[model samples]
Target: MFGVLTERQAQQEERLLDEEEKIPPTSIYNLELLRECKSSRRRWKFFCVLVFILTFTSVAQLYLSLSEFKNQLLITTLNRVKSAELTKDIDIIPIHSHNDEWRRLPLYDALRVGAQSVEADVWYFDSDPDTIFVGHNKVFLSSKWNLDDMYLNPLFSLIGQNNIAKRFEDENVSTRRNGIFYNNLHQTLYLYLDIKSNSEKTMAALEDKLSPFINNEYLSYYNSETDEFVEGPVTVIITGNYPYDYIVSKSTRYFFIDAPLFKFKNDEELAKYNHSCIALASSASLYQLTESRRALAGVAGLSEAQVDTISSYIDIAHNNDIKVRIWETPSWPVRTRNEVWKQLITLGVDTLNVDDLYAATTFF
Candidate 1:
């Protein structure tokens, strides 16, 4: 019985020891699960942060792009508005660039289309022996075309077909003359011719050809030799190339002064020489006036002295009932150009030289 009891006790002790040495798997599983949960939370947090940064960056870039687009649109709209306003205010049209196609337009159409002055660069090209033609440039060199064919022929034909308008009269160009064919509108044509290279003989020949036009009673002549400008009958427009002492012993209807202002010694000299002759001055020198007002006088090309020289020229001419005109100015950007125009208007500059027909229409 004792042996049996001892064996039972040993067995119980061994079972107890074994039970103490063994751990529950559920507890270990819970600890490991807790650690994994922590690691998963960390990874989720990192992913969320990365996503947030990417989303924010994307939004920022999108916003910037949209802002830039809006700014560009606004700028475009503003430019368009300014252009429209300028076009509305000015009666002139702006030809984008120099084009010979404008020559085909009727004379009256020129004014209506906003051309301040129709400029014809007259050059005689020798196509063959004894055959000369009026061409704008080297492009139109055929004998079939001449100045007469380019301008006068079309003008005469149009007027001949339409008998309602009267011929050009010297009184006021604004008036509607008979036999003048104005395209739909009653706009008159203003001719600004750049005489091509011609010698004394060629000039004489040109004069003879032009004599028929000159003899018409509807034209006006301004004799630069006499400094007498009248408004009646067609006459050869003369230049102020001679000394100022000469008076228009003969009557003339129109006059042009190519003289520079400084050519005269002083105000009195200018006054004495420019009596009763419509005058024009070069504006090539006035470009720098905007940069510095004090520097206005020193500007090159045509100095203030030259500009001031016109003061007397204008006085003498206007006092004798002649008009004064000026050439050259800031011709682009109607806004900027208008600044110059306003200044000239204040100074009583009659004609504003402009290359764009659209721009001229705006001013007139």
Candidate 2:
């Protein structure tokens, strides 16, 4: 019986040993939990590294884009400055101030604003040949507004005061200075005298008034015998009822005639008028040239046909070394006037006839 009891106790002890084997120790469970924590920490570290790389790449790309934009802006500003410098060095475009006598200051005002040419309408009063009145019509005539007082005297004063001859000599060795502007020593000032009365008497009066300038070699003249043109400070061009025959017949003349643009149908006709010898320029009505193109008016600017016609006239005149001027351009609605001015400039018009001197000077 004692032996049976011992065996039973041994069996109970064995069962206890088997239960211990099935269940894990506290230290072993702790080791498994620590392994899982280490794996989670490694994954977290990898995720942080990926995030850092992406953020670094985005920042670097943004910096490069900003740097490129900065470079482009700098280049644009530099180009604009260079363009302005180039424009400043170019010559002032020739401008013709129409009806200069009607202005508030006459010739003086036009010269002050850099107008290379000015027009004066002269009416010869046979009653007094000594006095050449400057006016658009007889009604606006005044004794104080004579050609000598309004134009000649002031010109003489300005030329002497500015020492134009000396300035020109110092600057240009070969070219002669003509215009009243001191800064520009190469341009010639065109004095357009439109005669409104008897051509014979008017010519005499004009010669008398211009004798001082002609004598001083300040007036441009043509010597028929020598076939040479003597350029001077001022070029006198006669238009509007000028005696063409009388002018062409002269052996030596101090004044040039403005040839009628419409009469010159071809090169032969242009030469027939002695355009190269006697005429300084040709004048035509701009309205007449654009009449056919009126249908295309403001929409497409000037038509191809109109451009060709205008260009042909310009070509003929330029071929003979003659400048072409078109007067009576549309003046109202400033935009249209500017457009016309732009077109004329683009077409290479030598002299622009403008009422608004300031606008024309600034437009370029």
Candidate 3:
């Protein structure tokens, strides 16, 4: 009786059997899950590749931008040499690095940013006349960091690097030797020497040290007999207790005097020197130039009187064919510093005397 089923019970049992067969087998269920996983893997791969492409593009843009200085127009021709850090597309700017020796990387730092002028305070201790020590004062000067070690040798190396190809190239490619910059071959780099010790001994030591550059025709020089300035890769400008008479008196000299802006009473006074010698740069302390006892600008920016005085001085300098640079400018209060810098630039100052290269770069 248990084995035998009633007709109605047999029909119900058959319906249950049909429903069980419609359900997928265990193997088929596992196959469905595998298909879903494959689709998910494809999507994940696409997303990763998209992210990688975007990230790579962003990094490339930042690399080119970080290496460029925005102070001047971009020079794109030198992209061939962009592989090197210093050989990036560097645009020459009229920024002067004041107290450049105080920087972490003296000549190289200024050059990387395309600073047109660099300052070095040279102190000659009589005890060792062989070396011209570089510092604001002898107390903190390092013997290892002399004029030759700090600037001369490194500069010559750069000059050599720039000129290597010229030696092998055809004469039509370039008739003259190149400068330290691969981007700007003709631009002159000013080396400002602030004489901290006796002018006589320091100049003598400097002449001896510069012999290598001089012999190589790498220095901008003034020939007294010819009364013409021969432009070169580097121009030496002497300031601060620098024997002005000595530079002017010499028949032939490699360096020029940093014309004291205060010494000239007016344009007429500037005219006399302009015709007589090559004073490529003129510098004055803000106090000495404007007769201000302190930083009168004081966040408000320079006064009307100060602005007028400065404008006149810059006009005199330009008319006389000299690049005027004003130092002791206000440093505090970002707004004030920027304001003064803008005003000076508007007034036609040739170069900004700056201790902060990064800050100054923004203005140009």
Candidate 3 residues lying further than 4 Å off, grouped into runs, are 1-84, 266-272, 293-297
Ranking by lDDT: 3, 2, 1
Give the Cα error of residue 65 in candidate 1, in Å: 47
lDDT of 2 by residue, 1-364 (tens): 9999999999999999998797789866888899999999999999999999999999999998887577546533433332123223344558899999877667755765677789999988778878889999898798867888778776655544434445553655544434455556445678999999999889988888888787666777788888888887788899999988778888888878888775566667687655446887887876566564242466445667777778877877777777888887767667767777888788888889998898898766
Between candidates 1 and 2, which one is better according to TM-score? 2
Q: Which stretch of 10 consecutive residues in model 2 shows the poorest summed lDDT?
A: 79-88
lDDT tens digits, residues 158-223, model 3? 777777776675767665667776677888889999999999888888888999999888999888
Provide the global lDDT of candidate 2 against the true structure: 0.75
Report the number of clashing residue pairs per model: 30, 0, 1
Worst 10 residues of 3 by lDDT: 71-80
TM-score of 3: 0.74
**Alpha carbon lDDT of residue 288, candidate 3?**
86
Q: What C-alpha lDDT, on a 0 to 100 scale, does residue 249 get in candidate 1?
A: 39
TM-score, every prediction: 0.46, 0.69, 0.74
Question: After best superposition, candidate 1 residue 146: deviation in angstroms?
Answer: 3.1
lDDT digits (tens) for residues 288-348 of candidate 1: 3233222232222223464454455555545544444555455445555566555555556
Indicate the residue-level lDDT of 82 in model 3.
Answer: 31
The whole-model lDDT of each prediction reads 0.45, 0.75, 0.80
